[model samples]
Target: MQQTEFAFVLPQGYVDPEGNIHREGVMRLATAYDEITPMRDPRVQRNPGYLVIILLSRVITQLGSLEQVNTKMIEGLFSGDLLYLQDFYQRINQNGHSRLRVACPHCEGEFEVETVPVGE
Candidate 1:
C-alpha cells in the first residue's frame, strides 16, 4: 500500500468559528462537571460544540470540494438525518471520488470529511 501525505490540516477561517481549540483546562473542567452532575449540561464534553465538532472540522479540511464539506458539516451536525448524509455521500461520489470516512473512537458515529480546493 502507498502512503499519501495529508493535503489539508485546517482551512482558513476555520478557527474563527470556535475562536480556538478548547483548552486542556476547559476539557478537564467539562469532564469533571459531567462526572459530578451528569445532568443535561452545556459543559459536558459531548455537547454540540465539543470534541466531535473539532474532529469534524478537521475532517472538512480534507475534502476535495465544498459540497462534501458543506453536506458533512451542515447536514450531519445540525440535522443528524440519514437522508441528508446519503445525499451528500452520493454527491461526493458523483464528483468522481469519495470523502474520508472518520469514525469516532468513543461513539459509533461514522462521518465523512472532505478537503475542497480553494478558489482562484
Candidate 2:
C-alpha cells in the first residue's frame, strides 16, 4: 500500500492566542467517507464554504504542539495556510501522489518533482 499521510509546513503558520506559532503538521489522505460525511454536516449545508473546514479537521491529525486538531483551530489558520492545505489535500488524495512534472527553465529538462503545499 502507498503512504496515506503527508507532512506539510505552513507558509504563514497559525498563531495561537498564547503566541505559539504552528508551522509543521500532518494530513492524512481523505477517504470517500471523509468527503461524503462533511457534506451532511449542518454547517456545510448552511454554508458550502464550511465544507473545507470540516473536511480538513477530519484529516489533519496534528499541527505543531496542539493537543487536538479541530474546526476551530483550522478556522484560525491564515489564508495562505488554508490554501496550502486545500491543495495538499487534492494532491495527495485526488492525484494519489504529491509529485508533478516540471521543466527546467534554463535547460528545458523535464523531470518529476515532489510538490510542496506552500507556494514559493
Candidate 3:
C-alpha cells in the first residue's frame, strides 16, 4: 500500500504551557483540498505566510501527546521546529520520500540522506 503518512521529529520541539515538550509527530500527504483551501483562508489572504500555518494544521494528524493538532498548536512551534516540519512536508508530499540530497565538497559527489531529528 502507498504510504500516506510520515513520522517526524522536531529539532527544538514545542513547549506547552505546562512546560512539557513535544518533539515527535506525524504528517500526512496533502491532498488538493489541503493545498488549495488554505489559500482562501482570511489569514492567508492577509499574510501569505499564514498559508503554511493553516496548511500544516490540516495535514499534521498528531503531535506528541496532543489529542488533536490545530492552527494554534502549529503556531506555538518554535521557529526551528516549524522549519523542520516545512521541509518534512515538502519532502513527503512533493518528493514522495523523507530525505534530502546532499553534495560532498571534497569529492563533488551527490548523496541522498534520510532526514531525522537532531541527536537521533
Candidate 4:
C-alpha cells in the first residue's frame, strides 16, 4: 500500500491560549484540489503569502491533540514551525519522500537522511 500521510515534529511548535505547546503532528500528501482551492481563497488573493497558510491547514490533518486543524491554528504557529511545515510540504509533495540527499564535503561521499523520521 502507498503511504499518503507524513508525521512531523515542529521545531518550536504551536502554543494555545491555555499555554499548551503542540509539537507533533501529521500532514498528508496534498491533492490537486487541495492546491487549487486555496488559490481561490480571498485571504490568499489579498496576500500571496497567505497561500501557504491555507495550504498547510488543509494538509495538516492533525496537530498534537487538536481535533481538527484550521487556518487560525496554523496562523498561531511559531515562525520556525511554519517554516518547517513549508519545507516539509515541499519535500513530501515534490520529492515524494522526506529524505534529503546530502554530500560530505570532506570525503566527497553522499548519503540520504530522513528529515521526518518515519513510524516514530
Best by TM-score: 2
Clashes of 2: 0
Put down candidate 2 lDDT per residue, 1-120, tens digits, no spaces. 898888888998889989999889989989889999998899999999999999999999999898989999999998988998998888888877889989999999999999866733
TM-scores, each model vs. reference: 0.21, 0.89, 0.86, 0.88
User: Which window of 10 residues has the lowest lDDT sum in candidate 4?
Assistant: 111-120
Worst 10 residues of 2 by lDDT: 111-120
Q: Is candidate 1 or candidate 2 better by lDDT?
A: 2
Clashing residue pairs found in predicted model 3: none
lDDT digits (tens) for residues 1-120 of candidate 1 = 422222322222222144442111100111233234433435335564443333333333333323234323433332322233334333443443435677999997998877342221
User: Which pairs of residues collide in model 2?
Assistant: none
lDDT of each: 0.34, 0.90, 0.88, 0.88
Per lDDT, the best of the predicted structures is: 2
Which lDDT tens digits does candidate 3 get at residues 48-111?
Answer: 9999999999999988898888899899998988888898888899888787899999999999
Clashes of 4: 0
CA RMSD (A), model 2: 1.9
Report, for all candidates in order, the number of backbone clashes: 6, 0, 0, 0
